[model samples]
Target: MNILLKSSVLCASILLAACNSDDQQQSQTSSQTITESKYYQTKTPYQPQQDLNKYEAIPQGFQPVFTELVARHGSRGLSSIKYDLALYNLWKQAKAENALTPLGEKLGADLESMMKANILLGYGVEGIRQFGYGNETMSGIQEHRGIADRLLQRLPDLFKTASTQSASILVQSSGVDRAVDSAKFFTAELIQQHPQLKANITPMSYTSLASSSVPTVEDGGVDRFKLYFHSLNKEQDLATPLSASQQAIYDASQAYQKFEEDDAELINKLNELAKNTQAEQIAMRVLNPLFKPEFIKKLGTTGYIFSNTGSYTVTAPNGESITEKGKGKNSIASAVDAAAYVYELYSISGGMKTELKGIDFDQYMPLDAAKFYAEFNDANDFYSKGPSFTESKNVTSAIAQGLKQDLFKQVDAIVDKQQSHRAVLRFAHAEIIIPLATSLELHNMMQPLPLRQTYNYSNSAWRGEIVSPMAANLQWDIYQNTQGTTLVKMFYNEKETLFKSSCNYARYSSNSFYYDYLKLKQCYQIQ
Candidate 1:
């Protein structure tokens, strides 16, 4: 699907591609292994983890009754012009000194195009600023809309019954603009396919609405306290505040903060790891193709200038743009970091595929470099968000508790017939998804290592791309047979995935993905 920079068409899900015979599923799945370079990069776009047609068969007599999904916001622009602004400054320095090689010279156009595309992402042809600032990119809309289409097909009866019974899809979000925008696009597709759902929903129609930055109580779907439960104040998650009922949630957040502060030993280990992992040799290798040797030496010697935490901009004469007003931080950093600034653009460019096409920064950074950086990036995330500390899951569990419980509570309501909502979808960020994934031990995310062992490509399966790439999500579908037998199944990125190892399905059945709902609670140690 093409994501236009300024003017664009609404490229929804490609359903025809999803329908393949079961025989082709294995070959397609094997072809896209995690070891493949395409899957390794952060810019990897959302691919449904499982082929829609090949998911394990639903047990006979079972029908899907309730569904819930916790999705990371869709692909989006850099939070601000941080990467573009930083790289623009570096590119200008190179141009002034005549340091740019043919490859290096291309950075300017790519950055500009990327910046413009980001400025216009999901903004329509006019490129309005309010929703354009770090908002969902066009590819993101495609990802969610496509998922909605696949979902409607997967559980056609649930939606149909919900419409007939007047059951609303109780929506929830982190309340951040991108996440809320994702929710909007997703629900829009649902209504587009099933007009009857219109009467069952809240009065506000988000799918057709313009992007918004305003915090809203209007969506009724938004419950920041549960969806935006992370304690990390460094980003937009804090935009949504805590209510009195959420006051207990603070105890967990405080505990996390206290652990990070008091654990001088762990801090020392992490610091030690950071000092050695620069991969300066690889940095030089990347820069060699882009700049002259003398220029590299000078950068290595003098360091390069970055900025205080803020976004910068380049306005067109046409007055087209998004958020800018960036304040430059006149700090010094190593030559490698400056090169990484290029890598940053290259990495983020993956999400911009729908908007900015045919731009290749991958030529600048080698696959090994990309892999190194991917791991380097994953290491830090391992501690801050993923299961940190080999011994305990303190960091993530604290923040993720509410989200996990929210899942349990909501699903229980459906099972017990307390609520008629067929699908309870929640939109959140990677922070929420990763923590919840690690806390629940989905994939190999449970492996939090000692600081010395550290997270790496070889040792840890907890990769950012596979774990929570653009539009990362975890969906739970509940099915029941008329005999009162309840079963649950999970789809990670829409692929059929098993729960924690202890969680067992019917051993005799051909399907490995389905699990007894009551046994699932016991496996996770849920009361």
Candidate 2:
């Protein structure tokens, strides 16, 4: 996990350490409380774990010949104006009803400020050069820049030759603004450090770098990734909805409550009615009847489950399009969505650069109380994107296959001298990164979750923070010796990681982390 800097590791002297000792003690005291709270997961900037200096030495005589990375976009602002507007409306209602706690009162202003900041940052704004629904934050820029700086340090020999020879580095992005920005920021730092790269960087876009969750007909009417994600759980509940007990705790403990004692009868009736209704509808009905229609609309018209050969059309990277059998939104009420804008309000208000702008709204939310919502979000991802629910095996496989093909193609091109690019960097979403990791059958990511089993960190090591934290990356550094023996070492989210169990080839005499490239490809039948 050691992020090496140019020419040396970061070294600190005794004076600086001693001077910060008192502050470190105070931080430790506060961090204990924050870390224990599940709300810690909800923090806006879920910082990646830092183990910057943990690198093991390369076997003597192996010089880095090529490197490739696939990384998630950096941390970004909340997507869309709808989230801000939705919460603002709800806050207005609470204020008008005189239900605002002192902490709650502060939330309205915070939301406005946050929305304005995002708007200025080009989120949901038109005519901005890099405008997108989710604009990257300054922290995001730093994240990529830091990654670039570290990579340069890690591959000094490779970069030295590339810079001297003026070899181009190919940068690919999904064409989304945040992703494009991530690529730019990363290379910006790279060129800044190695001036020769300024004339040799080429940024490109590949929109279909990953397949859609839904299936589509391919050329010759064949659908390679025909597994429809939504169809698999047409009626199955994927996310665990907030329980009545959890709701009651939020109402009683938080400074704000959506319902009053006078509404006890209505609450009782809604609770009973919720059993047979969709979770989304139940959530809205419990909070405010008037909000049901708008909230549902916000949920979108897509069906809850997957379908085959019905309506949805998926286009492949080669521009071939096949009509999918089914296309729809998920059926389960995203408990996270049922709760609507509440999650964003809590998440963005703390542990972010914006916190310095005077947002401390997390103080209003009790740590233990927020745990349910946090887990609810985790469950949503676990079932939908991770390995828990139906069709995940195929879904993840399909995702990995395409990226794997692209990866090996690049490797082949480099090895065959068909591609001159010394480095290949790809920027995409978590959907791409998570599944690719699963496809590689990386440890922790491959842990089994029975269809009925819910993902809990205590039981499994697959945490979102570790897998797809904003700016998360999987890096493969290829080294070659005088004999042309190529070896590959991988870093998952910057930590040296091992290959999945089935492909593990580390021998007693070899470094456990470094895998022989030929053996790895053979294990996966890549040829």
Candidate 3:
């Protein structure tokens, strides 16, 4: 017979003997069918979108002026510039159109009060020059402009809240033209007092500088100039003998401040209007259709089930039982909604409970006795070859051996999992075992080598094991007088050894042990 064919036949014989039951054959076939059925279904993927412009309430006269100011002061810091510009522009537009609501009026008044306070708090013209336009200015126009850009990008709700009303609508529709005219007039008057200011008052650029390295004129350079004017206005109030042109610039700055503040109020009122509008409600609503039973069944056939108990039993067209098992639960069309609910609950609550209090499994055992018996039989069947056999001592023995091997594999797996644990163990062995073994080997190697035998060789000092070859292991004493030096005394033990011999010149040889001892003692500061 051919070797491969013989081997295949032998393997087939072994497995056939091991699982020779009708039920086992049926179960295996059903599992194979289930595995084959998974390639025929499709599922839709989920996607999420950013929600902007969903707020119900928005301030009036806010968006357009805000946009314009931001356009003018492109490099200004975001939060301050956006808020202040929005406030100022809203106020200016509301006043111009005479469409300011009560809330808009209040917003305008509050902004004016805040601006005056800010100036009194020591942010005047010189202060603006020092910190508003310079490269190092803390609240530079660029910074405020950046704030507005980010607000528009990241906070849509806030944007809508500041742009949803009639006042804002009117401003957005015609605010740009008016703002441009106002800015020109303001700039002209500002230049009269401080000719240097004219150099800095650039027009707002309509094109965005969001992705650019430089600011454009439309990005709110003028608004920043206006802020600088406010600072100048405050300076005029405190200056001694202010010039007529300075006074005019200061007055112009005040007027601009009032207009900006009023525009801010109108913007806030628009936010309220937007909130009450049906548009806002429709924007915020989310729709999700329910899954019908038939649709669920189709999804189920597409691998939507999540759990299995001894496979799925379906009545075939022939009225016979068809059982399926083994493949993992398909999650295609299952309770996706329920799954979402559970996911949200887990997100909110952290995780599921693993332990429950006040439950008695023992008391329920009698009611579950039939299941217990079936489980016992199933377990026995698992351990033995099948129910056809009376017992399976051989199989149990083989299983025990397999378990032992598996346990060793488990230990190896754990060690593989923790690199640090293995490294520490290896380090310990290197530190403890290798050193000890080397020390013993060295000791054995050191012994029996020929040496001068004037010192006592029979004593334990000469015979003792070497703990370490690098340190002192012996001591000696000698006596000396003017006549000569001579051997005096010695001691020997397992811990240490001693020997002494002496010779005389005027002093011992510098290379001799006595000389070395003296030098060592001197170097160590020993007397």
Cα lDDT of model 2 by residue, 401-442, tens digit: 556666777777756667687888877777667667766766
Alpha-carbon local distance difference test for all models: 0.67, 0.52, 0.23
What TM-score, over all chains together, does every model reach?
A: 0.86, 0.66, 0.15
- Reference-based lDDT, residue 493, model 1: 89
Q: Summarize candidate 3's per-residue lDDT along 166-257 as a digit string, tens digits.
A: 22210000122222222233233333433443333332221122212122223422221212332334543534554554455455545534
Q: Is candidate 1 or candidate 2 better by lDDT?
A: 1
Q: Could you give the candidate ranking by TM-score, starting with the highest?
A: 1, 2, 3
Count of clashes, each model = 5, 23, 57
lDDT of 2 at 30: 31
Among these predicted structures, which one has the highest lDDT? 1
lDDT of 1 by residue, 216-308 (tens): 555465666567666544353345565654655665666676765676756664564456534576677778888888777776354455543
Instruction: Return model 3's CA RMSD, one decimal.
Output: 41.4
Off by over 4 Å in 2: 1-50, 122-133, 203-340, 349-352, 390-392, 414-419, 506-511
